[model samples]
Target: MIIFVYDNSFEGLLTAIYEAYYTDIKPRAIVSDEYYEPNLIDNRIYIESDITKSNKVYEAIKKKISQDALRHVYHVFLSELKEAPTVIYKYLLIAFRMGYQVDFLLTNQHVLNMHKISKKVSREKHRMLGLTRFQLIKEDFYYAPIEPDYHIIGLLAPHFANRMADQHWMIHDVKRGAAAVYDKKEWFLTEVDMKLQASVGAEEELYQELWKTYFKSISISERRNPKLQKNFMPTRYWKFLTEKKQS
Candidate 1:
């Protein structure tokens, strides 16, 4: 068996795929070097992230396949599932042979897998769009922390940037140790090693209390349904919600 190791970045995965097509022997697995533990029997190939190679693969997909399929590739990557890179490689292999029609080939497991993972990523992105709540922190920064199952912080950035274009905001994915920061103009993602100092403003505290009171006042005790509420707003996200906080 052969294993292809990459830098864990999307570009690195693309570079690995580029090299895989030209190799004499096909790789059995494509994995990030960070998670890859060397095996005694398997042949390992380390791939460096290359912009040119990654761009070539991207352009090829956009040209040979449909733009919609290219979007599927991105969404599947954002799923961050363990098998995502290998599944993408497999999907592309069939795509290169079958052209744009490969997307409709539900009989093909790889294509189906791509669609499944893409759906998961899209669902999380949509959920975060509605469920995310920001608090006013020190230095006039609007900080929102999320713990999505998928790598969706980047996906959430554009929506908030457009909605709150005049403000400086940061969406921190605490689980992933990454943050998407917007500075009134552009938004970018960065890896954060240390915990952020999340000191809420006094006005923010007042708003939180008021919001919680409003939430309690509007709910009819006899009509309350915890199960229904949990279905829409999962219990896992309650920690960050102002209305859910203890008075």
Candidate 2:
């Protein structure tokens, strides 16, 4: 049994496929850097990430699978689910064995599992965009912090740009050390260090006060139930939700 290992990145996964096929050996397992076993007795191959090889695999997938199928697979890859990588690999293994019909993903149990996981991930990405509340800063740049479980920075960038087109703003994914900045006509993604906004001093506290007041006024104490609030606005997420934190 041959075991192939590569870096734990999407590009690395694709490049590993290129090496796997080139070696013309059936791989017993495809493992990532995070799961490398030090004491391996099998015929193990270590693969480096190569953009060219990754591109070739992408091209092959596109040729065999429909564009929509590829997108679904990418979404599943981005789901941040613990089993996503393995499930995607199984889907690919089956796709290679069966020719170009990735739509069978709709029916295959393993593929279907990925579809569900991906959908959940995408839903969370969209929800965070709606829930994120930005504070207008001194530089006229709107900013917000989110610690999403997935790499959703690229996905949530568009909503703010479209809704507040005339404003300069940024939606930072603090967990990922990245942000999407938008001007009226253009947007760019940037990487920044993980640090709190240095300028958010006593003045920034005003927004917290206002948000807390608004939350209290809106809350119908007669009908308020902690259980209901917990269901939608989880306590785990309250740290970044200024209003929730204030209340």
- Residue pairs clashing in model 2 are none
lDDT of candidate 2 over 1-247, digit per residue (tens): 6777788767887788777767677676677767776675777778899999989888878777656556666777666554565676777777766655655647788767766777777887777876687877544556777877777766777777788899876676767666676656656666544455444465566445433433342343442211106755656667778687653
Among all candidates shown, the one with the greatest lDDT:
1
Runs off by more than 4 Å, candidate 1: 196-228
Give the runs in model 2 whose Cα sits over 4 Å from its true position.
Answer: 35-37, 41-44, 96-101, 104-107, 183-185, 197-232
TM-score of each: 0.84, 0.73
- The lDDT values for all models are 0.78, 0.67
Model 1 global lDDT (CA atoms, 0 to 1): 0.78
Model 2 scores what on Cα lDDT?
Answer: 0.67
TM-score of 2: 0.73
